[model samples]
Target: MLTSDQEIRELLTAARTVAVVGISDDPERDSYMVAEFLQRQGYRIIPVNPRLVNLNIQVLGEKPYATLRDVPEKIDIVDIFRRPETVMPVIEDAIAAGAGAVWMQLSIVNKEAAARAEAAGLKVVMNRCMAVEYRRLMPR
Candidate 1:
């Protein structure tokens, strides 16, 4: 787990793109809202939801991927919104996708997945909101 503010900042700053797993089509959902927020903050957001394949590209600027593996380009950060049980496979996919960091959203935590991602050389940030942290760490 990344402990220092600098480390977290570096990860957030260095990342150019984020793959938002389990992204929802509904704007009311946290997944969609966070993805929108991150996109607004200049993180190229690639929304991922198996259910929203056909509408993905039309909605999200970048074409949405059904799975992380479905993404073509390099993924710097993986923002996951799935359940705990769903995270391990997503982490495996993130490892395979060569993402530098894996961020599990607020109220979400998967210890095994976090440890696994960290062991695979990816920075793991669990139980944190990306938008909130971005606000806290980088004061505009």
Candidate 2:
């Protein structure tokens, strides 16, 4: 079954940290916007992209990891920002990395990948924007 808004909100609220796959350095990208949004909401945002190796520490903080395997802390959620065809490997990596949930960004679709994660005991949320859910569910 596809994840509900309630489930996504619960996951986001409970998750202390999130690893963003396919994160881009370009400020115009949605990935960067979402990452910054989550960070402002008090979630630890770790950028997971191989292309960021050349970036400075102050810019990337902990230096972007090439994959989930390179992340230092336990990942609560793996927010994917890539194409549908590019998400399977990231999902597999999330499971291997011991992530609690897999969140595919808005407009992105990957049912097969979501099912695989669900089967692996990881909560899966697809085709949704986490930032939207957070605002809708936690609008104080």
Candidate 3:
């Protein structure tokens, strides 16, 4: 797992495209807030939410894809906002989608899924908010 300040900072610096799985359309949600923040930081946000996609709701000015595989562009990171029990499938999709890293938001942690993602050669970060890490590590 890449949890060190330097490692996280490096990942944040190198990452350009983030696939936000389980992103919500509501602004009150952390997923929505984080995605919006990343968008403003110049990282392309690919919203992945089946419900929003079905409803034709766009998040952060990008069409929400039903899954990571549905996204056509290369994904640098897969940011997950789902529950711990539901994160395995998202990790699987991230590995299959060829993402460089897997980031599970705060309060979400799955050791087995993290192991699987690491085995697939993807950097894993569990129980951390990407936005918070960005603010802490990349203060301007």
Candidate 4:
């Protein structure tokens, strides 16, 4: 784990635009709730999911990208909601997309992938809920 609260706080403070990879169109999903909360907090939320491509849909008012490579702008953070085994490719994509950080949502952790992302110069936050951390670390 990246054991620096101050660092995490700083990261959260610096990040204004987040690409929510694996974000769901279903409003009841955790990914949706978290992304929604971030949007409400003034962050630009970019949803990414292959299903969106199939269905021609968007999430939370922003158009969904089929992949990180499909996004046309620089992403401050790549917030992952996929399973552990599916993370490596996403990490690689995040790196290729020039993202500043990779945030794995609650209960998701891939040490090897995290290492790779960190080695590639991107901050990694794993096994934590971004929304929870944001509420705890950032003052309103």
Candidate 5:
């Protein structure tokens, strides 16, 4: 697991594409807001939400994929917004999709899932907001 500010900042710097798992179509949601912020900061945001995919809805101008594996593109990071108990499947998908890292949003932490991701050679960041970290570490 990556815990240091320098490590996290380096990961954020190297990352290009992020898959936002469990993202909501509603703009008011934190998931949506963070994804938008990352997008505006020049990171490619791939919204991952099965519900939105089923409804043929787009989030942040990109169609939401059902899962990370369904993205059909290289994903640098998987930004998770789901509950802690539900993170295992997303971690599995991230590993299968060959993602470089998995980031669990604020208040969402699953040590088991983090371990699994790390074992699969993926960096893990738990209980932190990507937008907050980006703003803090990569100030304009």
Candidate 6:
């Protein structure tokens, strides 16, 4: 819903560390591929997935965290890959984790959650693809 290219560019340029919620281990998955691309672009990727924690495995060379609260570093952007119905709790966690921004990936949108995040002073972009936005906004 955030349509300003300048704002999106600013947020993406400012972000250095991204915590990818619901990231997958499978490379074929959109979450995994996007996270990988970000990692390759030098973003510190904090993978957050309960399944990965349950499996006790790392993804993309970083230890997988069960939740945003478990991540030690400051999260510049919390990129969510979960369903719209399940995003409120994740946004709450992102706020608690002190993230600078929240990005709900393509096909995922929660107006209430986005409003809450913005009200809490965190920049938000819902129903957009982070990797695509990065390519579009960041200088190539």
Each candidate: what lDDT?
0.87, 0.85, 0.94, 0.93, 0.96, 0.93
RMSD of each: 1.4, 1.7, 0.6, 0.8, 0.6, 0.9
Clashes of 2: 0
Candidate 2 error regions (>4 Å): 54-60
Q: Which pairs clash in model 1?
A: none
TM-scores for candidates 1 onward, in order = 0.93, 0.92, 0.98, 0.97, 0.99, 0.97
- State the lDDT of candidate 4 residue by residue for 61-88, as single tens digits: 9999999988899999999999999999
For candidate 1, write residues 19-39 as lDDT tens digits.
999888778998888888889
Predicted model with the maximum lDDT: 5
| Best of the two (5, 6) by lDDT | 5
Reference-based lDDT, residue 47, model 1? 80
Order candidates by TM-score, high to low.
5, 3, 4, 6, 1, 2
Give candidate 4's TM-score.
Answer: 0.97
Q: What tens-digit string does per-residue lDDT give for candidate 3 at 33-138?
A: 9999999999999999999989999998999999998999899999999999999999889988999999999999899999999999999999999999999999
Q: Give the C-alpha lDDT of model 6.
A: 0.93
> Which stretch of 10 consecutive residues in model 1 shows the poorest summed lDDT?
54-63
TM-score of candidate 5 relative to the true fold: 0.99
Q: Which segments of candidate 5 are over 4 A away from where they belong?
A: none
Candidate 3, which segments miss by more than 4 Å at Cα? Answer: none
Model 4, residue pairs in steric clash: none
Superposed model 6: Cα runs more than 4 Å off? none
User: 2 or 6, which is superior by TM-score?
Assistant: 6
